[model samples]
Target: MTETLAETTPHSDEPIPAYPMPRASGCPFDPPPAAQALHDELPVAKVRMWDGSTPWLVTRYGDGRALLADPRVSSQSTLPGFPHPNAGFRENAERRRSFIAMDDPEHARIRRMVTAPFAIKRVEALRPSIQKITDELIDGMLAGPNSADLVSALALPLPSLVICTLLGVPYEDHEFFQEKSSLMINRYSSAEDMIGASDALTDYLDELIGVKLAEPADDMLSELATRVGSGELTRREAASMGVLLLIAGHETTANMIALGTVALLENPDQLAVLRETDDPKVVAKAVEELLRYLTIVHNGRGRVALEDIEVGDATIRAGDGIIIYTGTGNRDPELFPEPDRLDIGRDARRHMAFGFGVHQCLGQPLARVELQVVYGTLYRRIPTLRLATGAGQLPYKHDGLVYGVYELPVTWDA
Candidate 1:
């Protein structure tokens, strides 16, 4: 085999401590006992990946955040000898149809197209619509007999509707997109299942782009299609951008809606404060804290070193893959005093959940707005909303990169 990166072959004195890595199985919401084992044993350790590759897993908050911001560690997966986890799958080619799979210049140019649309100003303009969606969902929830699966009644659909409307994707096909997106992240799905979902999502987006080209609408997708047709963006670039917006625009927010609702249900006192507090700033800060507490990306970030670099105590040389375990970092006791506790009041603005630097989530503002609207309105509307089932019985998606609940059954006195 061609030599791996120099970093992979460190000297004996520079020991690469062995740590337990998260497997594709196990509960996602509650931290895997294995991750805590690794965190306690070696804050920074060499983990043997499922794919039989060795990569440094950074566990400390400071180390993970610093590495995320470091330009030397490239997020691009197309590098030489770079082992993409999905490489052998027939569907990997189609799955790479998003901007997340590209490097700079290409990533930068494409990301810029939707930046303005997702900007705080643009997102703020959608508040009225978001509020309507939230209220409508809540209204429907109220009309239900007594109990409701918040995930289905409100959390899931709110963001899906908002994202679909924003992207000009047909709302009728929302379930189709959701299923494909779920399969893309689902842990239990086979390799063929994953590849198929990836391909299907790409083809669906391609068709959407084609429709957007012939008849533009007052939506982000239409705007992007105009740019692409005008020659500002290549067809491939346009497809990637659309896929990013469509998938991310809903999936992350959908989880936040479900997970955030669970957080409020579990902590009624905090939920009370959020309901009564009129301060958007405070609500925004609380959202950040909740994100940190629920480090959805339990598997850590997937990246490869572009050049020789030093992260924390160790030196990482070119080509060595790195997975910065955000879940571990977010809970590092050093960064977060009493890190495991859910303190919405805690100042967690520095958390790397949305990641750091260039590749930071582009839809953060829209997400924030969607979250604020959902949480701010839901509790106040049903001050007594409580989980209908025992917390243990709640369905959680364990296999995917994002560890989130499936259905959050909640009820309020009618």
Candidate 2:
């Protein structure tokens, strides 16, 4: 017999701590103190969410990986017991049918259509182009005032240009799409705001798809348009895929670039590790370590248990919600020794920063290549790169889905 929620509770007397506990003021890169404490005390325990529903919070590295890969755990947000990150997400869950929220067969089918462009080999082939883009952006930054917001100067534009080129979307309209995408991912956004952003993006993508169909281009959007024309996918489905790629392709990477830079700046020693290394293998490992240290998707991975599952001394009942605190998992002592330290030399490939299981991030190869180019080239070209302001004063995106700085003020000696 499947255990119920009540039966799974370890401590009936203790009040469940609220989910998404805040990070301490000065510790921007660290996971929330409360979350780390919870993981240390109880790797898997129930935590109350915004809607007054208490869901199982998995914080251990091993348990998080186990639950995420388990078919019994579903990513379908529309499911009755799915733990949404916030109110806006709950409201728009059913209406927005992105493949990230889907299960196999359907998810596989849709993902296959767009996977070719992001395959490791394909992304590797774009290294020279990525390097060129990185160089040009750094050149523009160097040409301008000595002090510039890295967020605008290089972090945001590099990925934006790359994705725009891949999708055949105009880079000139970045301001509009970036605004809508930001609103869509904002944890504090209202239901109406979220839906409006989705509608606007969907409409924009629909128009773009129409253009692609009439005048096919050598891009992912054109490929999606072809599928739509062949009746392999409905127009809405194609648009949904486009919107997913367009938003995810840039937003997550943009945030990673900024956040990783902040992390490197704060730890000049770690930055030196990258600056001194000329080996591609070393640079790639450092990127993985950075990805582990600063898991941009700080908000836990949301899911619903479809069946009774025993995970790390707790029984997750059928229909019970589960939130995998990946940031905490990345810091789990069992997984990485000196979990809090930012060590570029550590074997950090096992980190769940890009998630795991079938829903693992599709654009990871592209993201890795982009970061490899940026981190490798930026410091080499400008050896004196340093933050223009103190790390404590930097503005962080605590209210958004991805964790990053709002502005990374940086400078390098001429």
Candidate 3:
């Protein structure tokens, strides 16, 4: 039987630690040291959120993997104590619920409508196009000054352009799209400000959905329009999905590209592993290693338990909020021996970077292809590429919902 919060929650005189704990400085690639200690000692423990509500934090690899896949754990944003990643997420969640925040039947039903565009065959067909633009971006980057901020020059534009092409979002509107996404992702943004930004984006996307409905095209939006036309999804739900895709498809992938570049530059031996490899398998493995090493979606995955559940030694009772800290799970020495080291050659296929089970990243195939293309080509093409500024001085995204370097100032030989 499920227990009440007071009956189940272990409380003491000591204050509960904060979620998204501080990472050790100069080691931005690794999981937070405090979280790692929790993995070793109390893998299942309580932590405080922004609203002062305590949630069960699962840090061990085994426990997190199991709990995330459990049917009793609900992703529905409507759950009373669902652990929101940040104040902004908590703020706008109810007004802007996407299919990703829904439970099984609803999530599966809605997610499948958009799956065709991301099917391996469909995504693979874009490889030639991806490569062409990647080369064009690199050409543009090299033709300009030797020193450039890779984030603006290539990292940000590449994914935006690609996803725009795939989803039929006008490339011209990318700046506006990026701006709204920024407001939503800023953890410190007030509920009023974030909700306004979200509603505006929803309105914008709903208008575009209308356009797709009027003049159907061979893109994902048109596909969504067909569903809307069939009454399979309400207009707002379809638009919400569009907003999710537009932000998720670009932002996280952009971060990985820029952050991965910085990581490889810092560890040249690993950089050389990519630089020297001609095999696609080697490049793919390296991408996984990078994903494992720097799980940049550092915010813990949030859910609420529907029934009493055992995680580690603790019983996460019914209605208890849960935050599965994937970064800490990736660093669990039990699953990954000497987990701190970044080894491109090691088999990181089982990594939880894209997460595990039913809610694993929908855009992962496209992301993998993009990363493989960049990691395989970038360093090898420009063998001398190095940081224009010291790694220590580079601005990292400490407060943003996604963890990454804000600007990657890079330089290479003529």
lDDT of every model, 2 decimals: 0.76, 0.90, 0.88
Scored by lDDT, model 1 comes in at 0.76
lDDT of 3: 0.88
Give per-residue lDDT, candidate 3, residue 318. 96
Error of 2 at 160 (Å): 0.6
Q: In what order do the candidates fall by TM-score, top score first?
A: 2, 3, 1
Higher-TM-score candidate among 1 and 2?
2
List model 3 lDDT by residue over 1-414, tens digit each.
445544654444457898779888888887888898888878888898888989988987888899889999999877888988666677667778888798899899989998888889988999999998899999898889888899998899989999998888999998999989988887777887788889888999899999999999988988999999999999999999999999999999899999999999999999998999899999999999899999988887888999999876698999999988889888767667888888898888888988886899999999999999988888888899999998888898877788888899999887
- lDDT of each residue in 53-85, candidate 1, tens digit only: 777777777777778778787877666434344
Candidate 2 C-alpha lDDT tens digits along 242-331: 999999999998998888988988889988988888899888998999999998898789999999998867888999999998998998
Superposition error at 209 for model 1 (Å): 1.6
What's the residue-level lDDT of 246 in candidate 3? 93
- Score residue 237 of candidate 3 by CA lDDT: 90
TM-score to native of every candidate shown? 0.90, 0.96, 0.96
- List pairs with backbone clashes in candidate 2: none
Clashes of 1: 0
| Per-prediction tally of clashes | 0, 0, 0
